[model samples]
Target: MQYNYNISRITLNDDSHQLIGEILFPTINNDIVLLEHVFINPTFEQQGFGSLLVAEFVKHAIHQKLTVKLLDPFAKLEFAKHPEYQQLLINE
Candidate 1:
């Protein structure tokens, strides 16, 4: 199955045709983004949509050179799994 994996500075959506999940990373400062929430439709949970959202968000953060001040537990877990994304964290 192919998920849309949409990405933007403030949001990540799971699909181009449907909204299966989302990640909210709002800017907190010139160089920081606060990862406020990650919401995957309950029906879509545990199917990797959330992880794709985080991965795309992290990539965008890296590309934009914005550090992530993680508030979302879901994002924290995803971020913890990848070493490449460590430098993108604000407090790590």
Candidate 2:
């Protein structure tokens, strides 16, 4: 099934919109982005949105030439399901 996905990034202090899901990268320094967290509402799980979110985040990191430091297990699991993303495993 095709899903219309809308994921947004929330920084440390920006609170102006309703967040259905968020992937946190609290530290962006020295051309590196620490991809620390990824959360999708429980009601929204298993619909393939989480993979979309993580994939988009990785694309953003690559586009900016920034190294991604992933610290979330969920992110790892999601990436594992996608063979194309295997090389981006930061912990490997």
Candidate 3:
């Protein structure tokens, strides 16, 4: 299935304008974004929304030239499989 999600620091809403998921990348300074949390509605879990959020975050990080410090376990597993995305993560 294909899903188009808006990667925003604010929120991600569905067609009805209700929030279905969100990926939080809070900035600590100018060169890093911390992937603090990823939330998907229970009804939406296991449908790949989490993966999509991580993908979007990687894209955003590329654009902003930011390194990601991931806090979520799900995001870690998602990144582990994608070597390209793994490069964007902070080693420490």
lDDT of each: 0.74, 0.62, 0.76
**Candidate 2's TM-score:** 0.65
- Counting clashing residue pairs in each candidate, in order, gives 0, 0, 0
For model 1 the local lDDT of residue 1 reads 32
Highest TM-score scorer: 3
Q: Which 10-residue span in candidate 2 carries the lowest summed lDDT?
A: 5-14
lDDT of 2 at 61: 62
Residue 72 miss distance in model 3 (angstroms): 0.8
Off by over 4 Å in 3: 1-10
lDDT of 3 at 43: 73
Clashes (candidate 1): 0
What tens-digit string does per-residue lDDT give for candidate 2 at 8-57? Answer: 25321114433446677655567666677888767566776677778777
Full candidate order by lDDT, most accurate first: 3, 1, 2
Per-residue lDDT over 1-92 for candidate 3, one digit per residue giving the tens place of the 0 to 100 score:
33343443635566776666778778876788788888888877888777877787788788878888888888888888999997887777
Q: Residue 86, candidate 1: how far off, in angstroms?
A: 0.4
Clash pairs (backbone) in predicted model 1: none
